[model samples]
Target: MANGIPLDGGRHAGTPTVGIVGLGLIGGSLARRLVARGIGVVAWNHRPHPYAEAERDGIRCAATLGELVDAGPDLIVLCNPLKAMPGVLVGLRPLLASRPRITLTDVGSVKGMVRQQVEAAGLGDRYVGAHPMAGNEHSGWQAADPALYDGALWALTVTPGTDYARFLAVARFVTEGVGNRIIALDDTTHDQAAALISHMPHVVATALVNTLVADPDRNIAAALAAGSWRDMTRVALTDPERTRAMVEEDSRNVAALLRAMAARLTGVADALDAYDDRALTAFFALGQPFREYKARERAAALAGAERQPEERTLAIPAEGWQETLLASARHGERLVCLAGDHTAVVTAAGMD
Candidate 1:
């Protein structure tokens, strides 16, 4: 088994082709990584600036979205900004109507909203939702690097109505093509988890900077700032407009997470004010599980790349397949690849 996949896990006979909608950070990085791994990629960006560079990197640059479709990619990944999703979907609707075999998916941060827009465009049947857990505080093709996907994990969002073949296509694209791991989830579960882990924290990082700016002694604090501050506030360096758009698209989830986070902060403040040692201890203790989990991750990294603990084969059921994948993901199992239509090879739950 190469790249953690079984000999029978090859989902396609040859290197699969992909169509990219945007050439920004995430899309460009994926294109570069896939191409480096010998997968064929045809990409179209809203602007032609990235085309020259993308072509130089061996990615076929399409002059138009229609031209991208002409490449007959097995999967077309929508990497456009969330705001442009509706319009992009509108354009693709007519073009893709005759190409039902071409599975549609996106790298959108907010799956539920993207799925809604896809459904609104009457293309839901041809769509699956995907969000790769990769990226950085960068934008555009210039910032793109294939290394961005190193050890990346992706979430493939699905519903009961999603075609197993379509889901398999995207799964293979991630696992076999991109050489990444996959966790299956529904849109809501993905969105909520993303909000809790990513969106809310981005906002909190921004708030940290705002707090610094509001302080009259900010220059002094800045001079004394160290690694802890940098680690906590790094995401605040992301393009503000892009961050706002991401937070807004998943507004409900982000807002709810913000409320919960605020309560935690307030409790900490109250505890500190009262000098309650027990409350402070409890607050600190709450995170020990996560800390231990992260420690294990670091240990695993040192254990060598070839070591796959609790790796096991899963026989996918013909019925309740979606739930089967979702349940596995919920418990932190990652699908390495599909061995066959009714078979999945997975790694142990990460939290185990």
Candidate 2:
């Protein structure tokens, strides 16, 4: 197989084409968005219905995994569940053996195990693990939306040995094409942080729903449930099989976080039982600042989305002029001096 094939147009012109395996929620949404942005997408799905739908929508649907590889994608995204990845990687090894320049990534929540598997398969340089921190409780291609990834944080796992050029290419596609913020983290750090923010919370939501459903007055309580209960347990409505697979893959980290949550809950129960007003007040107060901080973060993210800057390259006289321009630039403006003959780049910032 050829190492690189010019897709969409010339090798470096137009949008980069991507091959996506598993046309589920994330993959389907990605296809829609990329197609809308004029990027070519060749997709393969295990299910017959979604494959037909993709074909009907003008997306090149590969009849087999091998055919998808034959389509010559610059990037291949494995969108299957966490446990299914190792097998998928193994299967793709023979097809990808000669295509070292083709970058591969995934949308799996956990990263450490995936990174290990990629390295074991001798694809460490060709693969980067990505987890987009965006999704609904819904599953399958039917629920996929083109705007699903907008303004979301897409975490990319980068280790010391990671291919920086490949990583940057993927990062550019994710940010400029997908409209997501790129957060680069190590595999271990990504897994640990995902456990606390996503995996553990998912377990808690499911457990809460289980506890409520098992109660004698469950139906009545459910009928009376307000936004607090609904918001907290919304993730519990996600596909059970998918959730089980994800949690099982990262059980150790989730379990440890669950234990801490249990201990904290116990202390809260004790405070309530003893009617410790001061302790209750302190506990409640502690959460207020964090809640406010998160609100501010959301606002800032929205502002950033609205104020995306445009980059421009210009020929300058000397390096000193570029440095002077950088010093005089506003808060969000960024200037970089290139290595070539008096070339400088400026990213216009805070422009509406």
- Number of colliding residue pairs in each model: 0, 0
Residue pairs with clashing backbones, model 2: none
Q: Per-candidate TM vs. native?
A: 0.94, 0.81
Predicted structure with the largest TM-score when compared to the true one? 1
**Please, what are the lDDT tens digits per residue for candidate 1 over residues 1-352?**
2212222345542233689899999999998988888777889999999887888888998899899998878789999898999999999988898887788999999899999999999999878899999999989889999999998999999899988778888887888878889999999999999999999999999999999999999999999999999999999999999999999999999999999999999999999999999999999998887888899888877887676567788888877998999889877799987787778889875665
Ten-residue region with minimum lDDT total, candidate 2: 322-331
User: Relative to the true structure, how large is the alpha-carbon lDDT of every model?
Assistant: 0.87, 0.74
| lDDT of residue 19 for candidate 1 | 90
Clashes of 1: 0
Candidate 1: where are CA atoms >4 Å away? 1-16
Candidate that would win on lDDT: 1
Candidate 1 lDDT for residue 152: 92
158 in model 2: Cα distance from truth in Å? 1.1
Q: What is the Å distance of residue 4 in model 2 from its true position?
A: 12
True-structure lDDT of candidate 2 = 0.74
Model 1: residue 150 alpha-carbon error in angstroms:
1.1
Q: Compose the digit string of candidate 2's lDDT tens values, residues 150-169.
A: 75767777676666556655
